[model samples]
Target chain A: MNDSRYVSTAQVAEVLGVGVTTVKRWVDEGILPAHRTAGGHRKLLLADVLRLARQSNFPNQNLGPLFAAGHALVPAHVQDLEQALFVALERGDGDLVRSLIQGAYRRGVPVDDLADGVIAPAMQRIGHDWETGKIDVFHEHRGSQLCVAALHELIGLVSSSAAGRRPLALGGAPEKDPYVLTSLLAELVLRQDGWQVVNLGPNTPLASLRKAVNELKPRLLWLTVSYLEDADTFLTEYRQLYQESDRLGVPVAVGGRALTDSLRARMPYTTYGDGMAHLSAFARTLSPGKRRPPRGRPTKQSNG
Target chain B: MNDSRYVSTAQVAEVLGVGVTTVKRWVDEGILPAHRTAGGHRKLLLADVLRLARQSNFPNQNLGPLFAAGHALVPAHVQDLEQALFVALERGDGDLVRSLIQGAYRRGVPVDDLADGVIAPAMQRIGHDWETGKIDVFHEHRGSQLCVAALHELIGLVSSSAAGRRPLALGGAPEKDPYVLTSLLAELVLRQDGWQVVNLGPNTPLASLRKAVNELKPRLLWLTVSYLEDADTFLTEYRQLYQESDRLGVPVAVGGRALTDSLRARMPYTTYGDGMAHLSAFARTLSPGKRRPPRGRPTKQSNG
Candidate 1:
């Protein structure tokens, strides 16, 4: 017991009742905080040991200060913008979104960069919290409104160009799911990749969409659906649309949480999984060239 | 057809053969890049639409370049360092671990922060690629080694005073389901929460862990098992361990992908679904005296 000066990873495992390799992995992942002595031996603090004992039974306590202290121990600028954005959304503060975006832009963060780094992550956290029941429906709705309004304003800030960029069709499933944020993030990512987007705001009728396709002759349609409940109905409608659209040479791309399900087999189109990372990939597939490096690529970088 | 100068969101949706609601959601999510005309009508670029159409069938193909583009879009100062670290890991450059740590530290970024923000994400990407056969086992091993070494060195830089801060024990299940990354991430999170961590690494023998618990009497034992294949065995062993550990007055905390499965019943122990967020909550649980704002309380600052 007196050997508390320096605890071997094995001893630490014994204390925690875990395997030695797990301890090493924790060390490797920077999970278990440790330090080496002048002689290069690892040591663990006593207090942390006690905290671990309590953590198993009780999580969701306030350890912010402890984390803050630990963060202070490590050197780096902690990005708290996402949390702030979440709060702002809950409050439905379009003004706050504007200010945040302006601030990020002033800091040399691009519009798309703001969308990806700040807006998207913030939205995801909000969605996750809302889904987990940590935040109520009203709070989630308020946040969504603020974000959508801010995004609209951001669209206004970016100038309309006549660069002959290809047009994209964007929309999502019914309001019951209410996850338009995924589509918004996708739009931002596509715009960043130099694609021109035509965002049809949520809840458009299928007949109207078919008519638009017949009239406008858009080359691609991008759809976002987050709920699995409407999968069977949506697929039935999608099959009809797909069969019709194929004749017109217009392709449809589907994405969001719903697409992750195995039911995708019933749908004829492509499914993009969670995150803008996948959305951007879907957008890229629409472009006719082989995979090209972003910087050296020939496309003009639009502020949109 | 001649109205190509401006396309209504409705028209765009029709062109894509999807419901207007779907299109609007895309617009709202920023998935479909769009510009509003002076009258506030959304316009889509023909080229962008065409590109989306071409890529609709192959979503996975977009991953590589999108990831590359994302890395490129990060702030320049961090970009080179991040890329170098990833490349080193990709190449299995063992010395690069120390060099990257030193470089980041010199630039005022803590090694832990770098690992969390950059290294971990990169590793996830590499792991995904490895799983999908996009990257070979060699690359995966190389990246894992570099990360392991880098994290170990980073832990070495902390002061012994920090080592005395708190004690935590970290471990996971056997090697056939080797997912030490989760444990590693958990350890970092706990450490950041001011707990001193003893990482047991991976594929640890259960008996040895029990023996360690007897010897060290550490406060907490963290177990991570990421795969589904070992869930039944793990659960059986976990029940036994729970009974045994209960006798010792130590709690077992469980986490990783497997914990979320519906088939698995909620055990008596705590389960963390999200990684860092869960760890943060776990830390708070350990320290009851800390002040936590109500879930709905508005905070002024943002956390990214």
Candidate 2:
């Protein structure tokens, strides 16, 4: 192992402006990946440290020592983010992928663009590679896991922005859709614009969604169809959900690769989005200004 | 709706050591629950604000202004935490529930205690209420949703502490379990002790676990069976998984409400945990000191 290629725990702590204990704790928790020396000292690759610093959005001047130490930080460009993300996912370097997305967002890349341009394409390429036998099934599963982790972190970061009295947006992947990324992205995108979201997550049956709509009474309902187990069952149940949403006067935003031209033609969604940009745009139309009050149904039992 | 009982966003910002914009953002994102005045100003109840402060672990001295406003801040006792959590969940107060859990954890409550003492009993009460017709199904669902959200937030907070070269612990809820909280809690408890966890989430089939074992080769495995749809299938599949894990020398820790005493006799596990405490104790036994390298299988394709 090349010791010079890695930085010590204290060096990373100083760079990130945190105590050494915090850095050590972060490493122990698997937040910051590190290697143990023969003498049991923790060391981190300079590249990983740089990624962490960038993701934390620390000032450039604070990272002067890192550069002075002879390690180069290859700044990822917006155009190359997708490629970078793809490589990170392929390597199963979850922290790197997280930092790339979060660092870009903190640097002012819009959520919709990140979703539509970066993650969507990178994940699509991963899928394509799997289909062509370029990657193993485990590689593909690992990619999804990395993506989900990154998205959850982003959601936590962005969630503080969508405050009081916002219109609620409830959504999930359809039954057998199985993909968690698209639905999670939808939550993040809507949340970026300050919509309260109840993400039912993947494999949500349409009947449960209808029940959710009746119970939660969200202003908007979004569905991401990644893979359908049975097309006929989906079409029938989805149509029922559409009619239910229509009766409740709620707008539905539908998207995902599984919603091909043929499928779109048969479904009755208020908006069909090709990407997060479209979802962002469509959701904006039903923003807080048009917030609808819950129906005049009898209120459920109160805790009081 | 009483203005006198409410505090402005600025007041919350001051107490929490953040900017007014950040407070507004938290309210917008539903991180902080707030009420909108007829004049369009955001005002939060004093109790809710206190919950937020406590959850954030802000010092009491900084909360002098809030105290002077003539609103009492009820200091939740350790014994009362479960009751408070139950009330918050019953009211569908996700933010409060999150604040309660996060605040307790920050104040030195162990992860295992929080899982076993606070969350489990509260959720169990909610389940009992639903069964006895004391609460509607939505109330039960809402409780689960709130619990999941709180657990995810706590996971994100604790993740920074578990930094380097930790043993990977992989597991999830079995197919038809459909409960996310137990599996997530398992992840948090393990992560607290510096374990790298890959929680496959609810509804994970046994075959998927077998595949994951072959690929990830985790040092340990855990399954939280909150609900079982079919006994015979789970038994057969679970037996196969137990044999596989045993063959690979991975310890399996099993728990949850659905794992009845009868089911235990039928399944084979290295350890059977009744609560998070048992899981936590069992996991510590297999800590990094007993670290095992990946098996002698040929290394798969590397991103490098």
Candidate 3:
């Protein structure tokens, strides 16, 4: 493994005959096994990028080596769109807000980029303003509602494009969590990858998750922890949830800001991701059909 | 005795300073009484149409008698767009499908009209084609997904425009009912009337509804009856649901095609609607603050 064997995302896109954004999405999703430079620019390993270019002809691109060495198509960013959206949110222009979002999605902006890059920072600003008395609670609430609605619309819009029975995915915020957005983000990201995903919504009890597990029988269950008052207390509450999930034989994946190092160590059975992108990447590796045993049948491990 | 009380929907629309589609929607929703002639042309009762015009000025439109007397606007029937959507769905053009729906909606075509006139009929055609072997199950399922996704996107789009503290409204299809779409339609309609709505999704158990009512403390609960295998059995199942809703002090409203006159007569606590438009009109009349007492306390009626 050569430490210096790294290529810029643009070079990867050129080698793949796709947009830089697409290449970045693959790298960001951990699909191409890329690393970041000291200045925080994405740098894909040359061998990994070349291997990916070879493996995923994508059936549509039909590119040869010459095309693989194609020139970079276009640059990607929403420097101005983000500002326009902030103003639109403040003014509460629902139509423009949606159009802007839809346009971005159409332009190939990945859901994770929309969530972490744009909305997250914008939402942080809005929250900070509300905290410092720069804006009223009503204004903040209205802003929040606009963002949530946009996400819901975007999710619904992309979800329609799924042509067949995609992977089954279910997720929601854990009990006492006010953070529903992350779950929606996860749903959108998963759905974009052609997963038939459902969000259980915020403040979901563990029993409710267990019930959903039994009913929907989803292949993957995502528990989002947006906040934790006490790491000890949170771990204590979710430990039983993990045991129940294991008993039910469902894969449990966890993520969010509150998962401290100690808490994560204690719940080592769970898979973790930093955000929607990571979760989506992990989901790509799961197969619902192969993972679960026939209903009420003995596990293959047990049979063995 | 006035047989000439009936007028074309266009005439009614012209007199109301609204589009022809609005009149047709009003008639279709049972908001204003109307009947179809032998040629299947919608003819509204002049008296009923006038009464509705008097009642619904709708904040933005400043139409007195003069606006009603204005020239006839564009033609109504979503027929052409529906045909286009059929092709789009057949070809799996997601963007075109969404564009068609959004364009219709932007042209002042109400949600109820879209659901009843376009999607319902198009879906029927798709189902028929599937049954006749004109298309495969994959085609039918794909078409259904497109329609459902459009609805979800539409709901999110409209729900964002609501301002202020909206009355909390909750709804879903009961267990074993494959009627998720109706619940979503109800959500869109209610949200338009400044109601904070939550759709619990299809195949919801009564126990789940009960649990949601207790937790969310919604002012009005909508239980959509999309299908009933046995009227008597269905009535029995939801009668207990009505009692649970009553116990929780939340009013239950039921709708959908499966409802029969005989079955409906037994459930006196429920309000019924033809589709989304009527349900929206009904939701407008609810007052959450005045209707229920503070949570965990006895009802004012009981305390008194």
User: Which runs of model 1 end up more than 4 angstroms from their true locations?
Assistant: A1-80, A91-94, A105-117, A131-133, A174-177, A288-304, B1-304
> Can you tell me the DockQ of model 1?
0.01
Candidate 3 on A1-304: residue-level lDDT in tens?
Answer: 1112335776565545566776777655546554432234564444344334333333222223222222222224765666666766665555566666756664446667777666766666676776897755434444565676677677754542222245677777766665556777887777665577656565665555666566667778888888766666567667776776777777788998778777788874558987777787787778542221112212221111
Q: How accurate locally is residue A113 in candidate 2, as Cα lDDT from 0 to 100?
A: 92
- Candidate 3 stretches greater than 4 Å from native: A1-81, A160-164, A229-233, A247-249, A287-304, B1-152, B156-304
Structural RMSD, model 2: 15.9
* TM-score of each candidate's B chain against the true B chain: 0.57, 0.70, 0.64
Lowest lDDT block of 10, candidate 3 chain B: B58-67
Better of 1 and 3 by lDDT: 3
Off by over 4 Å in 2: A1-15, A18-79, A124-142, A161-164, A205-208, A214-217, A230-237, A288-304, B1-79, B124-145, B160-164, B205-208, B214-217, B228-240, B288-304
DockQ of the candidate models in sequence: 0.01, 0.05, 0.04
lDDT of 2 at A290: 50
Per-residue C-alpha lDDT of model 2 across residues A106-145, encoded as one tens digit per residue: 5446789989989988898998997897876556666776
Writing each residue's lDDT as its tens digit, candidate 3 over B186-237 gives 7766765557766666666666566667766888998787766666666676
Q: Deviation in angstroms for B10 in model 3?
A: 21
- Which candidate number has the best DockQ? 2
Model 1 chain B: ten consecutive residues of lowest lDDT:
B60-69
Can you give the lDDT of residue A179 in candidate 1? 53
TM-score of predicted structure 3: 0.43
TM-score of 1: 0.34
